[model samples]
Target: MNITILYFARIKEVVNYSSEQVSLPDEVETIIALKSWLSNRGETWQKLFSGSGVVRAAINHELVDDMATFDEGDEVAFFPPVTGG
Candidate 1:
């Protein structure tokens, strides 16, 4: 399925792109799987999504957990945890 992936905050700087359109292979079905798939791109991806960072996700503008399932044309976004003072 095809999905639009967005990067925000530190993720955008790490990934080097604000957004991208990706065609996911059939094996990828959830947000966690998507992260693994993207991480395979290179060292940078691996480091950014290694689960050691406070990464947050949203689908179609709605916050979702790792198990969230998405379909074609879905907009998936990745960002760091927000903090306020």
Candidate 2:
């Protein structure tokens, strides 16, 4: 399935990309699975996305948890948690 992936804030900086379109492997069915799949890209990906809570995720603009399910054409975003000044 094809989906759009968005990286925001420092996550963007670390990934060196703001957005990308990718075809999800069949094994990747949920947010956590997707993170694990991407984290295989390299140490950079692993550090940024290998575990829970390090970054926040959203699907179609609504924030979601690790277990959240996404499908074809969905927009998935990742960003660090926002903090007050």
Candidate 3:
């Protein structure tokens, strides 16, 4: 399946990319799996999605958690936790 992945804030900076289209293997059906798949890209991806950081996710513009399931053409976004002063 093909999906559009987006990065925001520090996540974007760390990844050095704002967005891209990803083609997932059939086994990657959930957000958690997608994260793991992306993490395999390299050290930078591993660091960004290491689960130690406060990463937030959204699917198709609606905030979602790791268990969220997505299909082809879905828009998935990852970002750091929002903060305000």
Candidate 4:
């Protein structure tokens, strides 16, 4: 499926791009699956996406959990947790 993946904060710097269009293989079904898939891309990908790391995600601008389902043309975002005091 086609999806737009966005990076924020340090993730953006690590990935070297703010966002990119990706065509995910059929095997990827959820946010966690997507993270695993990206981690397999290469060193840069692996470094940026830690399987057990605490990364926040949003599907179509709505914050979602790892179990969230996504479809073709969906906009997915990866970012660090936001903190304010």
TM-score each candidate.
Answer: 0.94, 0.91, 0.93, 0.86
Number of the candidate with higher lDDT, 1 or 4: 1
Residue range 1-85, candidate 3, lDDT tens digits: 9999999989999999999998899999898999899989999998878858978999999999999999999999999888878
Residue range 1-85, candidate 4, lDDT tens digits: 9999999997898778899999888988699899889888798888766645578999999999988989999999999888768
After the best TM-score superposition of candidate 1, give how far the Cα of residue 16 lies from its true spot, in angstroms.
Answer: 0.5
In angstroms, the error of model 2 at 69 is 0.3
- In terms of lDDT, the best-performing candidate is 1
After superposing candidate 4 on the true structure, give the runs of residues whose Cα lies further than 4 Å from its correct spot.
Answer: 51-53
The reply for model 3, stretches above 4 Å from the true place, is none
Prediction RMSDs, each to the true structure = 1.2, 1.8, 1.2, 1.8
lDDT over C-alpha atoms for residue 33 of model 4: 94
TM-score of 3: 0.93
